[model samples]
Target: MKIRASRISDSILIAVSGEEPDPAHQNISRSRRLLKLIAAFFSLFKLLLTRYRRPEFGSLRRDVWCLDEREYFESFQQKDPDDSARGQGGASQQEQRSQRGKGKGKQTARLEPIGDLGYSGSTFFTTPNGKYLIKSLPRRFEYKFFTRDLLDPYVNHMRAHPHSLLVRITDVVHAPHPTLGGLLGVAPTHHIIMENLLYGRDAEGGRFSNKWETYDLKPNDYFFPERDIADGRLAPKSVKDKLVDEFHDHVRVSAANKRELLRLLEADTQLLADHNAIDYSLFLVRYPGPRASTDDGADDAVPDNVPFVDSDASPWRTGLVDADGKWTYRVVVLDFFWARHTFRAWALTSLVKSFNKVAHKGPMSITANPADYRQRFLKMIQDIVVEV
Candidate 1:
């Protein structure tokens, strides 16, 4: 299979050139807007939810809690709330997304849109400081993901496979059936907070980001980055070659690292399949090389671009560095365990897939059995990982 790496270019000339008018664009935009509204709405709602949802202890998975205003958002230096954002110390109707933490003790969560996100809603954002991701999702999906099928077992699963590539859900601010309703329905809206995978968001994400290279990997079609093929396009064939060439110039890991990555992928995906869930993607990132030594923040990070090489520098290939160096990853196996296929849902998805329409991206990701999911995932990797 030909792996054609795609990129996010503002030049939609690529995506729009031959495409027919898409009604989905409205949905895509509205969904994105709803997503943004949720983020903003929650910034205001946080004032209330925190009162009830503030941090809980004894857990890192599915932990919920509020940033105590006394400790997190309060400060003598805080500006008067805007006229519209009066509640919960929110900016009145006229104020900005996050209150500026400008005073001597003012370290309130300064929020802003890093960019829009999602398949339908482009509604994902991160803190300016590059620490966390905050966004909302449909109530039903959120509920299912954190309960019996996903959240609890995830803890034991991660424990059993310590190196699994699951990004832990750190905290959440859940609204019980908001009066305003979900973007499309009456379902609740959940604000998910987690570690910023890949990189943190600053004000400039729409234009740029801290990420240097990111491959959002899924199972089929072409080892991801499929531009022209995945979506109808007639772009150049050299796209993959250019990207691989670029990857090798900056990153090269050893055999052990490759195996470790594959191991993690298999374990994590199998876990997803075990739960009768699928439709997730693997995000592999290559961090930027450190700035010049003379720069002031040089000491704070891994001095840019230097791949971490362990004792056996085995030349890890595939996705960033090998086992030796700084593990070239900001992995988050995303979009999983939403519907518990229970016995019924899984059976339906499996049965429908059996009729053999185009593959639902990857079937195991949907409802295929765990063993089958794991085997297929690993087999695909074997086919692609060239003697790394």
Candidate 2:
């Protein structure tokens, strides 16, 4: 899934590509506009008259709150709402069909559920285009902390530092469904939309043609109930499978890349540490292949939105290659919602300490302090990312 660079002239033409005016169609369009105006007037009148009532759980509006509208819109190179509306309204049936035919390779983004992936009980989903991931915030405190406390800081941080390794969260969709809330104590209605790190890996004959390996890594030099506690050890393989870390080897990169990687990680984790957040993981995806040439005739690049072709250091979407050219690595910091101040975190801290003491082991990663966790996280990455 090579992304072709879009041209300015092509964009300009497409922006103003509405059909020429016809006398017969003019009347229909005028009537439609008049009808729409009438409808809007009535809707406003109805709103003014209707009593202010709290929205019901199931019937509540599914609000799509875009965290960074401009960033994502430009990054995706999506059509403007007005342009889409115009295209739909002005196009003839034949023209509409023709437009659809032209959109052969592109896919309409849709939510597809990806059943249980990790220790975190949150539900997961991916967009049909494989560009975006939707992860549910099953815990109330987690979602509340994100929206109430950390949201502003996170947005500000991302805007201030574009090269931060933190996963890009573009939107938060709050769909209050009675069924989910009523069934589970923790309402899984709030979902976070993020960029998928392993994007384009599954695409046919693209830059990511090589088989990609992924690892959700964290500090393992601590007491883990799955490996330490008796009950956890006795648990089924399925349960233990979720808690395992598959990657154990070091990832070697150029000294410059390593320094940049650590610098970004340090800055990103500092924000999380300040906010008393913990239990974050570095989601790493790597493939054994040479970096794709920019002049590969495809010109598969989104101008200014994606990584710079000239610089070989930080490739945001394309990823960076190791010094040996044995691997192309993409990394994003993930799952930074678990704050120390949260009730669950506090309780778990106590439980973890008691268990650790009994087992005579070190501090558990999930139960460690924000600052301590940040240190461990950085060290974990430093230990693994060998400077070549």
Clashes of each: 37, 0
TM-score of each: 0.53, 0.65
Provide the overall lDDT of each model, using Cα atoms, as 2-decimal numbers.
Answer: 0.42, 0.58
Could you give candidate 1's per-residue lDDT for residues 135-210 as a string of tens digits? 5555455455555457667767755654456765554544433434343333224555554554321223222244
lDDT of 2 by residue, 1-388 (tens): 0111111112111222222345776566777877755553432101101111112211111222222322232222333344321112223334533563478522222245565567656767664344567676667788888888888787677656666778776556553323322234333445676777766565443444345688888887766777767767577788776664667777777888788888888899999999999888888887654443343323442122222112112463357767765567788888888889988888988887786676767677777889988898898888888987
Model 2: ten consecutive residues of lowest lDDT: 44-53
Off by over 4 Å in 1: 1-58, 61-108, 120-122, 160-162, 182-188, 200-211, 222-252, 288-328, 340-370, 383-388
Error of 2 at 236 (Å): 2.4
* Predicted structure 1: lDDT: 0.42
| Alpha-carbon RMSD of each model | 14.4, 12.4
